[model samples]
Every structure is written in structure tokens, then in C-alpha cells.
Target: MSSSSLPSSQKQVHLLKRPGRAPLSTEILNVVTAPLPDVSNLASGHVFLKTHFLSLDPSMRPSMDPSKKSYRPPAPLNETFWAGGVGTVIKSNHPEYKEGELVLSSAFGAQEYADMDVAATQRNGFFYKIDPAKGIEPREYLGGLWGTGLAAYLGMKEIAKVKKGDRVLVSGAAGATGGLAIQIARQLGASYIVGVAGGPGKAKYVVEELGADECIDYREANFEKQIASLSDRPEGGMDVYFDNVGGQTLDAALLAMNPNGRIACCGAISGYGGSYEGLKNSFVIVARRLTLQGYIAIGTFWPQDVYQAAIAQLATWLAEKKIATRFHFYEKVGVENFLDALKALFEGKNWGKMLLQVDPEWKGEGSKSAAK
Candidate 1:
């Protein structure tokens, strides 16, 4: 990994076909051996990179659908699949970049090597330089301090505007972003936080591990009743809600919010595969006078001053133990395993951040950073 030690060709994942409502399979994402980037003549603003870790997230699922209108374009057919990842600079033609520097970029195709134009990455939001001297781990960047944490920070701090004594509720409480939302709400001084998760085990994790006052199991028939009962409001409702899973959970949260409550609409995982008619309680927004706003992270939706300052605050909380985090690591062995990892995310199998070490030889657990 120190340099381009790759052979004549390397394995790569390509969008062979889009998985539109059908069951996911290897045929959708085909892996084939492809030649490495020609570092012989690197592009002007480009640097030759060796991917170390790839972030396997739910966001990738939407980009798979070419017909869907979203925050960005679909992954081009037959191209190296689009993804975010951390890597080492094997060689650099860019004046500002140097060999051996570790950086994270938004579109480091889910392959071993990518020729990145650092300027383009910077222009878009995160060509983030992982600072080893800051006492944060690189893998941590992939977890709580990067996109995931950034989402939680935006949802809880900026969008929801959670204040002291606010009774907050979070759906997808055991998953990566939801897990952090609980901790961030606590840091924001939420008096009593209730989490909505899929099952008993995840509910327990949300309560005991992630510091929620109580977590409701959505699998139960009376899950909505459970949410309604936790409200400390005079009308028996939550003051703020951070939504990740949208479907019945959103409907339930809608019925449980107090008048003028705030909701940070983050994701709709339950409806990602298209069957998401989960919000029957649309009238609740009108009935309760709620403020709900949807946003895209690592993008130009917010001002840089607000975004960067929030990111720094999250890192500070991570470093100061003001916040806690967990990561779910999956080593990239079979290209099919990456697909499985995505399935695990959609099925709520991951406990925290879901990541794939794209480099097969990297064996170290990221409790400590790769560089430090």
C-alpha cells in the first residue's frame, strides 16, 4: 500500500446493471480485473490513489437507479461504481498533494485505484485531509467524524435546533446515523430522548449503549402506542424528532410530536426500494404545526461557515468524550460481500458505521488510525 504495488490488472466493481425493485444479486454489480490507472502521465490536478477503506452506505442504493431524480446523478453504467473512500497518495502530479498523504474523497470508485482530481473533489465538499496530529483516527473519519457524524450534527444541531429539556425522538436508533443522533441529542441537552428501532436487541443498544432514555421496538404491534406513551409533553408528544427511517415509524412520530415541534428529515430507508408510502399522517404536520426540513449532507445545501463549524464541533465532542461512537467493519474479500454489506444496511444488520477495507492486506482494527 505504500506505493502502486498492484499487478498488470486489478479487480474492480462495475455497475453492470441497475437493481430496480428486483432482488439484489452479483449480476447487478459485476467484478472484473481491470488495468491500473496510468500514473505514467498523471492529469494536471490529479493524484494516483490506492483506496484503503470504502464506505458502504445506504446512499449508494439510490444512485443505483438511473431513473431516479436525486441530489446527484446516477452512477454511469459499466463504469467503476461511485463511492466515498479514504486512501493513500501513491503518486501525485498536483502541486499541493504529496506521496504518502492520506485523504478522503467523494467518488473514489469502489476499486483498488483511482486517479483523483483533488481540485474537483475540493470544489465539491470533501477532499478532506485526515489530520493525524489532531488525535482522531482515519477510520473514525469514515465513521462519526465524517459524513455520518456530519449528518447527525446537521439534523440535531442545525435543522432540529434541539435545545435543553427538549424531548427528542430518533428513528433508526441502532444504525450508524441514528446511533450518533442519540448521543448528539444528549450533548445538545435533550432532557429525555426516546429512540425507535427495529427489534429488542437494537432497542437495548439504543438505550444502554447509545444513551437514549428508552428505545421502542418497531417490530411490536403497538409501536406507535409506545411512542405516544413516551411523550413528556402536556399533549403527550415529543418536542423534536430526528428521522432516518421513513415509513410507519415516521407516521408514528408524526402522531407523537407536540405543537410546533421540529423534525429533521434525514432519510427514508424503509422506502428506499420504492414501496415507501409510510406517511399517512401528513395532516399531523398541519394539525400540530410542525416544521420539517429535508437536507443533503457533504453538499452545497448549507453555508460553509455553518457546516465546517458544526463538523469541528462534532470532532471536538468525539475527542473530548462528550460523544461516543461505534463502527461496523467488513473487510472487502469477495466483491459480492460489498453487496451483502449493503443488504445488511438496508436490513438494519449493522450496529454502527458500516465500512469495507477495500485493501485486502490491511488487517489492523481502526481503533487506531492507519497512519498514526
Candidate 2:
């Protein structure tokens, strides 16, 4: 499919009601036809992009909640829901933005078109141009390169404040961010990289594919014992902990940190659906002088230097065959499938970043390519 044929309208996902006690319903959200928003009079700094891809993320689940201030605002009832998406500019009122430019933003109601104050919505810089001639795929921007990759790179390098020769432990090591965190730790000269993940296959892949020095299966009945057995002395304790899965995994890391160890609290995918029992090992922070830092990817705190550099390096890694990637594309489906895609994330059924292909150009087995 050529880019010219890509749909140019209000491509949107609608959420009917709150998911009460059970799982969110795919049937509840039905795409409705609405007039394409007129952006001719949009506020300055506001620009519109014809969305090509919509990122499916676990953090978005909390947005469905009716509560007001739980990280992000809840989706308004009976209205079109919003999300992070990448698109090409079909129209622009902002002076700096030109029509036909590609960009990414935190704007929601991820329809085929979006209008927002480009200055307010653009994170890590304005909608970046997507060079279609490059070997890298356009979808990568929504997944590893844009979403999870930035999460891992920023969480480890900046938030965790890692240093060479330090020992690092990563939880949820098979997922996109966790997997990338492992590699970044290794590249930063970590002495040993330990991975904690669910199931045997993930553990094996963490070691084999991600180059983890060791991997512990969290599903094993002797999970704690397995983690304990891998220890030795003062140096045996981890210097950095890159946490993606929370709950037990966090509790376990709190138990293993060396004095003055730092932790990058990226996400708690383990407790994604709802609250879980809080950590019992809270004492460790005081006992070990550990620093726990939490973050969301935005503002000056964002790892722009690391992110842009990594993208360039990632292309090289792919060319040199030093890095590998995997994706679980949920083929061309309608806006109503939003709940199903989100459910797959919370259930851990998805292996990498989940993305919705809103444009026909991205519907096939392969989409646009960037530099490899």
C-alpha cells in the first residue's frame, strides 16, 4: 500500500463505559463516524497528523479508570478514548510544522487524524521526521525505538544512574523494555546482568538472546530460593535494579540490593490490573541505603541524548547483527479491537510492544522501513 492511499480522516477508538469489576470489553467500544475536526482555527503550536500507527501500552490501562489522578486522567465516558500515536501531518496551522511531516505525540482518541498544540503534546522533541528510505521499519518508532526502547534506555542510564563494572538485575527481562534494559546495562559495562522473568522459555531466551549472565524463572515454586542461590558476598549484591514488573519482583529486588544501590522503578506490570499487596521488604531501602526513583517518559528528565544516540546505534546494531528484535503484530483490525489489544498486554500474552495499524500502508506483513 502506498502512503498516498492512507486514509485521511478522524480515525478513532471509542470507549463506552468503565470496566467495572471484570476485564474491559472489546464489544463496548465501537468506532463511530464523526465529522473530521476542523483544525483551520486551531491554537498556535497546534498541528494535525494523519495517524498511521497507534501504540498499545500497559500504562494506558489506568486511563480507563474513572479516578482523576492516578498517574494519568481516566478516559471520559461515552467519548472517543485517546492514546499515543504516530502520524503524518495532513494539515498544520503552526508556523514550524509543515504539512506531510511525520510526528509522535501524547494526544489521544487515536483516530486517523489528530489536532493538538504541537508544543504541548510533543515529547522528547516535536513530531520527528520518519525517513522512509531508511532500513528501519516505521513501526519501530511506535515500539522498540519510541516507546519501550526509550523507557528502558532512560530508566537504566539516567534514572537508575548506572556505572561501568556495576552489577545489574532486570525484571520482566523478556518484554521489550526489560530486554532492551539488559542490553543497555551490558553495553554500559555491567559486570554481570541477571534477568528475572516468567516461565522457562523466557528465562532461557533472556540468557541466550539478551546475553543475560543469569536468568531466574519467577514461576518456579522455589523462585526465591533460586534467586538466593545465585548470591555470594558484598559484591554479589546488585548495584542497579531495572524493575519493569513490580509486586514480588520488586520485593525480591529490595531484598538483594547492595548498600547505596540504585533502582530505576520503570513500571509494575505485575500489578497492572489493580492494587496488589504492597511490598513487605520496605525496610531494605533504609537498611541498604538504596535509592528508588520512579519515572514517566517526559520533560527534561527524559533521556533525549541516550534515545537519539541509541536509535543511530540501534540501526548499526541491526546492520552488524549485534541486536535482534521481535514483534507480535495484531493484523488490521477495527477500533473496536482496542480492548482486546489492551487485554493481551495486561495478560502478558504480548511479547513485545503492541501497536495498532490504523493505516492501510501498515496493514501488511511488513510496513515502511527506516535505517537498519
Candidate 3:
């Protein structure tokens, strides 16, 4: 496609203002049209991309708050919100990149198009070229195969050091990373795996569909009792706890942990909506001698070899059908629905990895071939 034929303006979602303690609203995020990027003006090592899909994650909530301290910098007010997305390079001035090549980047804004500096993306440690021959869907890179999958792998293998015969418990078991963590624990030879999720349907999906040994509904009145009933091993408690919802669930898991247990604190979605339940059993960390560690999925935070090895192993497992991936996609949604899609995460409305399909016609390699 020639520059003259390309679009003059593109839709994008920008952070209009900082959200308060209440749930997110459209007032904080609004859709607007901006001038489309011109590849002819691209500097060296820069590429112009037409975004196809955008990833919606829980971590984005905290990043919107300038008061909150996190591994990543907060999103600036009145700017396009940062997100992980897959897009095709419409034009490129970089030697390493070419037009029509699909790539994944964490720097892509919640917009229809982007102008990327390839070297800067690499320097920030958040760029990947999607090879179509891999036989994996491009959106999977934003979910299980790359983003969420990598986080689960690093948390289990590196942070928790999960091993054979260990009793593993995963909180937020129906979410993207949580679901993958359950399967990863099973693959690592966990003798028993318990998944905690909200609603009966989600619990069933976690247990029956994801092959978890047991699933406990967090919304149940006897949530703690239900968890306690599952710790019937020789050690009398859980050996590994992969925590995604970190309020009372973390407290319950702490009470159910055996001596020398390991806890991988991946997220705290329960506390993201401006309220946090204090852990009543936090003293168990000292009494049980548990090792609790928090981690961020950014490449710079982890060793280079560890990241590559995990991705390689995850790719093999995916190809061999040992691990299954699921996505809850919003089809043909415009950038205006960005805040609504994000609200689904806190409300426990999404079944799996929540994603926005910016371009409904995109079909990965098929779309590329047809464009030719």
C-alpha cells in the first residue's frame, strides 16, 4: 500500500485523567482520533505499524496511577495508554524489519496505528518478531505463548522452584496467567493441584478443563474451610502457592502452607480496586518458614537465559498439546471500548485472557497473503 492510499487519521484511547478509588470509568479513558503516522518521516531503525489486537491485563490499572510505585513507569495523563499488541509493519526504515512482517511489542499504544523505534523497543526489553512458520496464532503471543505464559513459567520454575510430588495451589485459577500456572504445575509433576476461582462455572473450567485436581470457589461462604479440606498430604499442607488474588485468598493459602513452602506472588487483583483485605495469617510466613517472592515479567528483571529457555519449553509444550490456551476476545471492538474491556477484569467477567480485536479482518498469515 502506498502512503497516499493509507489512512490520514486513526482511532486511539487516551488516559484522560487519573482514576479515583472507585472502578474505572469512561471519564478517565476516552477515544480520540490522531493523525496517522507517516513512514516517510520515520528516522533510522523506525517502523510504522497498523495494530491488529490489544492485550488487556490487570497490571494496567496500577500503571495508570502516578502515586503507585511499580517496576514500570506510570502512564502519562492525556497520552495513548501503553499495552502489548501485535501489529503488521506497513512501512519500515529499519534494516532488521520489513513491511508486512508481524511483530509484538509492549510499547504499542491502545491505538489503530503506531510509529515504533525498533532500537528503543529493544533497549527497553519489550519486542519480539512473530515468525508465522511457528504455527502459533499472533494473538497467542500476547496471551499464553508469550506474555502470560512467560510470567507463569518464570514464577513457577524460577521463583517457586516447583518440583515433583509437591502439592500446588493456584489462586485466580481461571484468569490467563492463573490457568496457565495450574497446567505448568501439573507438567512439573505436582502430585496434587488445587485452583481457586470465583463462581462455579469458572471453578469447573479450572478443574475439569485445565486438569486441576481440585477447584475451590472463592466466593463460597466456607472458602477457608474448603481450602483446608484439600490439604491432606503427608506434609499436611501445600508446598507451593501461586497467588494471583492476594487478599483473603493469600491469607488462606498461608494458613494451608507447609513448612518451607514457596509462594510466587504474581498479582493482587483483589486489591486493585482501591481496597485491600489485610492478611490475617501473615505471621504464618515466619512460623512456617515460607519463602515468598514477588516478580515482574519484564525481561530486564529476569536473566536472559532463563527467559529464552522458558519460552522454548513453553513453545514445545504448546505444540505437543501438553498445554492448552484460552482467550476471551471482544470482536470488532473500537478503541472507545477500551475502558469497558478493562472493567471486565476487576468484575471477574472475563473467562480467560481478555483481548480487544482492533481489526476484525485480521487472520494472521491468511490476511497477509490476501493483502499480497
- Name the runs in model 2 displaced over 4 angstroms: 1-11, 27-30, 38-48, 66-69, 123-126, 133-136, 232-235, 300-325, 363-365, 368-372
What lDDT score is found at residue 371 in candidate 1?
28
Model 2 C-alpha lDDT per residue in residues 246-334, reported as the tens digit of each score: 78778877877888989998888766566644888899899888999998754455456765675676567655655555565555454
Best by lDDT: 3
lDDT of 3 at 109: 86
Q: Which ten residues in a row have the lowest lDDT in candidate 3?
A: 363-372
User: What tens-digit string does per-residue lDDT give for candidate 1 at 1-372?
Assistant: 544565666778888888888766788887778887678788898998888878888878777886545456787889888878888888889888888888888868778788888888778757867778988878787878777899999999999999998999999899889999999999989998999898899999899889998899999999977776655455367999999987778887888888899999998887677766647789989988999998877778889899879888988899998886788876344344667777777877788888877776554456224424
> How would the candidate models be sorted by lDDT, starting from the highest?
3, 1, 2
Which of the two candidates, 1 or 3, achieves a greater lDDT against the reference? 3
Determine the backbone clash count of candidate 1: 0
lDDT of each: 0.81, 0.71, 0.84
TM-score, per-candidate, Cα-based = 0.94, 0.82, 0.94
Residue 19 lDDT, candidate 1, scale 0-100: 84
Task: Name the runs in model 1 displaced over 4 angstroms.
Answer: 1-4, 231-235, 331-336, 367-372
